[model samples]
Target chain A: MYRYDEFDQAFVAERVTQFRDQVARRLAGELNEEQFKPLRLQNGVYLQLHAYMLRVAIPYGTLSAHQMRKLAHIARTYDKGYGHFTTRQNIQFNWPRLDDVPAILEELAEVEMHAIQTSGNCIRNVTADHFAGVAADEAADPRPYAEILRQWSSLHPEFLFLPRKFKIAVTGAAHDRAAIQFHDIGYEVKRNEAGELGFAVYIGGGQGRTPMVAKKIRDFLPEEDLLAYSEAILRVYNLHGRRDNKYKARIKILVFETGADVLKEEIEAEFTKIRASALRLPADEIRRIEAYFAPPAYAIALPGEAALAAARQADPGFDRWVASNVTGHRAAGHSIVTISLKPIGAPPGDATADQMDAVADIAARYSHDEIRVSHEQNLVLPHVATADLRSVFDALVTAGLATANAGLITDIIACPGLDYCALATARSIPVAQRISERFAETARQADIGDVKIKISGCINACGHHHAGHIGILGLEKKGEEVYQITLGGSGDETASIGDIVGRGFASDDIVDAVETIVDTYLERREGADESFLAAYRRLGATPFKKALYGAA
Target chain B: MANETARLWKDGGFRPNPWQDWPEDGALEPLDPGTDALVPLERFVADPDVFLARKGRLGVRVAAGEDVAVLAEHLENIALIALEFPSFADGRNYSAARLLRERLGYDGEIRAVGDVLSDQIALMRRCGIDAFLVTHGPTRAALQGGRIPEVRHYYQPVSGPEIEIPAGSRPWARQPAA
Candidate 1:
């Protein structure tokens, strides 16, 4: 939760007025289609297949109760009674009129939000661990760095219009919840021999028409030289990255074209020139920025704070939610409460207006009014007291938000496919809903263990299928929605893209296809605690493919 | 986007019945000349000697030997400094325009010619572009060009060297572009 300073506030406010004028001119017939196309896009107002979709940046998936309520208000007043929370930790309203966008932007600015750089070729909303300051295992909060990048990249003169959209995600944990390895630019917070915190930088990792695990360029980039080093990378890409064909435009294509070694050499040379200059982060500024994301005050210790054990002994319903949704906290008396959006039949990342309000109220009451939108398409009450876990679970159940599928089999990261998105080739929600139905039994889900089932409607990989433990890609085959499953992908410190297990399954067979893989894992897994990814690595896709395809 | 209201207008464009004295809007307004067409920057033939001496060069300047630091050389003389916006995203011209006026301080007919859009008029002025040359069409035609890229711009720069009536401010004319 970084609050806007005068500079940040002024910058966003001015951008809103700028967009308002641009919209006025367009409506007045002062600008034509060709001239206005790029303008609209840069502001995150897209002319989709159906209507204009404005994507509001929820920077790194963090939101205060105020911001959430504002989004809910926007949904009620300007759009259909809902908003689609995207995988990048942003929100998209599907049916905004072209002319009303500036007004929409004006309203968003009131909440310290604007749509700048949300859709442009510039550095996008810098994503970080959604559990940044809350997770018990976190080495350091990643939001300070994310916020720093946000301020520097907003309307960055040189890199605004790049060859294609750029994405960066950061994580401080040894376990990668942020999916850093799958982004265009990924940063893993690591400590060197001297115990200095810096980033292990990865470049060219992305999923689109071509998927790649970003190759590491810097073993450790000193924290201070982040901007200079990033500029060096983007400058290199801008000068050399392809623009001839849209498909080959991403930095991944360059990595593929000029091998990682050559690219790394070029970046290092470029970094040397800028690192010794003004772009370097001074210690004071870094500390000032870091202070915005300081952890909430928590009691050092709670005697017998095994609230989970107490709740489990008292109530079965609370026990199920606690077992699945409650996770480790950085503070002794606090726990990370994940509010699952994936109900039995609803879309994975959608929130109805009322549900949004309820979550906001819950966050305000039980969790310091701070809310986090996970890349997994779930909301997180990041710093809830461990003692209040059961009460929060109770409120969630009443609101129909309690699904007990945080990291379990049914906890799916889904993209808005053909149903709402213009880029989708098939329906991802239906596929996710079907799989969730197959694993609806609480006991069955608990027994199956933590398996990330990510479904992407198309190659954009918004659902993060590449990092899912079991990635399901919904594609069109001869005009029918077919699902292709991949095994063993991970999004942590040891991240890897899931390998295709076998041929795709038809829409009807997708659920059975998932069940088939799970059955294989159960039979071959060495023990109960070894998760799906561990088993897949131990056994590989060959065993799973055989299990699904049979003999052949 | 609104087609119904568009058909009601005659040539000069949609005025209700009692319109005032204006051209019937037949021939489109020709664009102002480009640097190559104008005689200044286009005149310096590979060197700055002749242009500096004010010899017979009646053309616009790419850069006369009058180094920005040697401002004493050309104080009274009028010149034009045109910022080339190769593309909208390239902000080099933005800084270049600001320095030419506020810092190194060139007092001349500052012009933003290439790829100039009407919406940027206010900004171009603040940064010092006094005149403009629309590359493709007449100014009126350029006005109808699709969506304006930004609803708001952080800086003040105009599309051309024109005195902008800031949205709600009183109409007070400051020193014009040159």
Candidate 2:
């Protein structure tokens, strides 16, 4: 929703030209593969197993219908007619040729989008709550700040070659939909007792080979010091973070090794020096950015409850969908609808070009012209009038986007693993597919209630397996693919890393292993009111471990 | 001795390199008077006053892993500080350069040396490196051709005062002087 000003336009156009030249140099052999890798990565191009993958940043997961349609066009024209929305709320085209990538970037630039900082060892695309401005519980919209950070981190001169990749996530609500605690830097926009706005800053939380929950470095940082504080943190990390071991190079490891107290002191010292510098965001600039994300106009009154209830009662299918896919909005008489990308058996986040176009058309007509991509690998219609729910549902059903599995067991989050990823050690999509098929029965899913099954092909944790209630990590052990399961991990406000429960499961047996864990939760839950995560916390891993690994 | 592709780029174009690198292992004694020798930071810090009081102009070359804090105290006397890249991908010096310019307010020449490439030239300049000792062939050619690829508009301000911050625009948006 943030429009590109003249400065923004010039910046992206220049970047496109720069990247195009770099690509030409690479193709001409003026730059070797090793030399060109980081450059290409910074532009969000990765040479995958079969071909190049182009990841386009959907800043803060916000998209205009026009932008969404452009994405659909890129998918149709360049890539295999579909795009995989990643866990970070960005979209990846698995089969874009190197030659076509600059063109794709050109197209993105025209739509106020570019893939800058989507990858490589730099501050990555800033993510926020998918239900940013629309959520009923949010204190403030996090997207404006996300946009500000996006601008600051783009082609940042000092931080471009960090020891390891960094990710920052922000949330403005008490319930952490953006999973802020599992990021290198996490911010929760909050109002103090005196009603002054600021942030609760969390540092160093990430899930890779070594999963870590971020430490709260500051209880309150004033909104004006946002960029300054972030600069301080990054400066400290850049100067002191480990470069010897790539695996231990994330800011989390720095926090872990230096101890949070010491790291906090160092960061605070740096903050004290630069706090009054130019990086301190002026109040006017903050307000200027905030204005762009102000809420859309809604009708003064809309009679929707009766109509929605009638439609639900008339069609059980519609009722099920409304129950699962729809959520309450901050504005009265409006609802936030999640268009599920996770179908019964297909890849978790892949959406066809047609589905994308349909979503764009639907958003343009029913909701405001805005669309959102949730980190759970689903698309969101953030401001649909409640009266239009039935029409939205019907359109979604026709487009095959009306899957009533928003938070159900079948709503899995998985990465494009060994199938397309060069970093993957095992196949993750197949495991997710098998589990989705096992839990395909809507009745069974309803009985199970809110459960998240996440799978990653390798320890890199691209699948976010460490944050799932039922986490499965696929590993190559002795030339055989095995899945290691973890229990009780969560990415919400109550964030914790899942624990590995005994030995790994063979690919053929992973689905049954997942089913066993689900069955154990169902049997042991206090009541239907207790979700899988709550039940796991109460019961601990002993019961789930026992169920999976037997009495031993 | 410098790499074969190393060219002295300062101000806006390549010029003869006046400063010669003083090897870390080489003895500090017996250097010619007024010889512009860039010694390693470790050697310079071993005896800061010795280098500061030397007849020749003082320049210190800092490795990517070395601390730049030591140079803060002697900034007024130092003529040049060469920050090493080790490789183009190692960016520790960028932070070091910013610290020198913004934190320590060092106005002396800040040069980027070692593995310098065409793509990184613009970034080095923004981080307050006023000069470059480029060792990549294509980078030298690009510099010679005045074809350094760059996005002149910046969203964040670095230390230098020459950068223009247009009024009424977003405070963060900056453009380098034409």
Top candidate by TM-score:
2
Best by DockQ: 2
CAPRI category for model 2: medium
Residue A338 lDDT (model 1): 89
Give me the overall lDDT of model 2: 0.91
Model 2: per-residue Cα lDDT at residue B29:
66
Chain B global fold similarity (TM-score) for predicted model 2 against the true chain B: 0.89
Q: Candidate 1's residue-wise lDDT over A402-477, tens digit each?
A: 9998999998988888887788999999888888888899988988899999999998777788888999898998
**Tens-digit lDDT string for candidate 2 (B1-178):** 4543248888887777878777546566656768988888988899877777778898999999788888888888899999998888788999999889888889999988878878888888888898888677778898989878888888888765356665246666688766
**Which regions of candidate 2 are displaced past 4 Å?**
B1-6, B23-30
| Candidate 2 lDDT over residue span A171-242, tens digit each | 999999999999999999999988988999999999999999999999999999999999999999999999
Question: What stretches of model 1 exceed 4 Å from their correct place?
Answer: A303-307, B1-178
Task: List the TM values for chain B, per candidate.
Answer: 0.46, 0.89
| Model 1 lDDT tens row, B76-140 | 44355555555554434543454466545566656554565544544555556555543534333
Interface RMSD of each: 9.8, 1.3
When summed lDDT is taken over every stretch of 10 residues in candidate 2 chain B, the lowest stretch is B160-169
